[model samples]
Target: MTTRAGLITSVTLLLFVALVAASALAQTNDSVAAACDAKVKAPDYSLPEWPEKAEVKVFIVAADFNPEQIAAILTPLRNWSAVAEATGSQVTFVYSGPTAEHQDCLNCLTIMRGKVHDNQKHAAELQATVNQGEQTILYARLVIDRVIPNLTALTNAVAHELGHNFGLRDCFECRAGTTVMGLIRSSDGLTGPTRCDVAQVRRVYDHVRIYSAEVKRRKPQQVAKIVPVDEGEEPVDDDTPIVVKKP
Candidate 1:
């Protein structure tokens, strides 16, 4: 998320952020940076890109704690997917509970790397929202004692992190006025992408563009195929809850 770290000392500017925390639902190990700092590598096209007409399927991984609650949260994701699809992008939500076959198990960006150990604590970031181009993938496993009481809280956390999985930079509400890719701070953490984050997924999907599916193995892949921004589609306002349905 775009957080203005402590700005230079100035008499007028008394507020300056020291360190903005990232979102907890993002890639635990992979997401560490915001935008590409080095260079923008041209996407290698081997397989065909996502067809505008075809729908993109995504696999979701949910916690075993509460199946019913998980389903409820997914409904909003489905609706949000429609928003992206209508903008030349499509998404198909896949549940990854009980069976996390392909999805690398959602990871937590907030989790520290050195804090690795076995303690029935599921320390390994086993939950994250994976995205391939326009295809957005989410693995919802965050639960207290296996079940969550506040559905609204669950939706807010997961959906915000999913936004990062789609490659949109996370930022504070202050940045929303300037860039579409603004950082959103939540009770989870800051939102940023690391080397193994968006770029890696983008590479794999981009490869599919040049080469046909003949060589590509049809194992269980995440999401795929996202078209450019369509005209007249305004970005969702920051305050709009991603997972809650309006009454």
Candidate 2:
């Protein structure tokens, strides 16, 4: 009992609504990207980053962290890898097991626990040695305080520190508890990198390099292994590599 013209009009209205929603979403993303760009602060007017398609090996000190603590510490690295995969940025952080095995890794990052000096109030710190001429990172170390309030705090702390390793500086202008690079830890249940954080990473590695063609031909590598730890079960110490790639 419906006219052909009436059915066509209904379909047109539905399509219009869908288009409007898409436009609004795009605008929101643009606004967030702009905010992220403003927060980037480079040292000496230069941004230090790793090479294109580089696989920076990561090793955690087993004596300093237990299974549960290790899981919490690794959450941020996995989050960054996931973001990189989604954005098609060829860089990734691969977990290479204990520090003893990969001591001679060229581009390596080690995370260990250390004392929190009374003079230094920070919960964690990152020390990166960058090659000034090439603007590439050679090696880095992340030292986390021995005593932290909770796992959430530890996760956020690691996320903030890792941001430094990825060529991001602290954003003093960012609103409190909004970005991982901000002065204050986010209070709003965010345990990983934000869209703003990843945007800056993409911006840092946006240059075309001589090895682009070679990188494009390479396959994705295993980033990390995250096994579920059940209640009342012994913590499994499996160092099996797991892959976190874009679908």
Give TM-scores for every candidate, taking all chains together and pairing residue i with residue i: 0.33, 0.62
The 10 consecutive residues of candidate 2 with the worst lDDT sum are: 228-237
lDDT per residue, candidate 1, 1-247, as tens digits?
A: 4334533444224332211112221332132234343233222232122332333334434333266556544654565454543232343334333434343333222111122122122111213333443232333222222222244434443444444334333233323323222322223222222333344334433333323244444455555322221111112223542221111
Candidate 2 on 185-209: residue-level lDDT in tens? 4243456667777655655554324
* Residue-level error in angstroms, candidate 2, position 199: 1.8
TM-score of 1: 0.33
The lDDT per prediction is: 0.32, 0.58
Candidate 1's C-alpha runs over 4 A off are 1-63, 96-149, 175-247
| Top-scoring candidate (lDDT) | 2
Per-residue error (Å), model 1, residue 16: 46
Residue 246 deviation, candidate 2, in Å?
Answer: 36
Number of backbone clashes in candidate 2? 0
RMSD of each: 19.3, 15.7
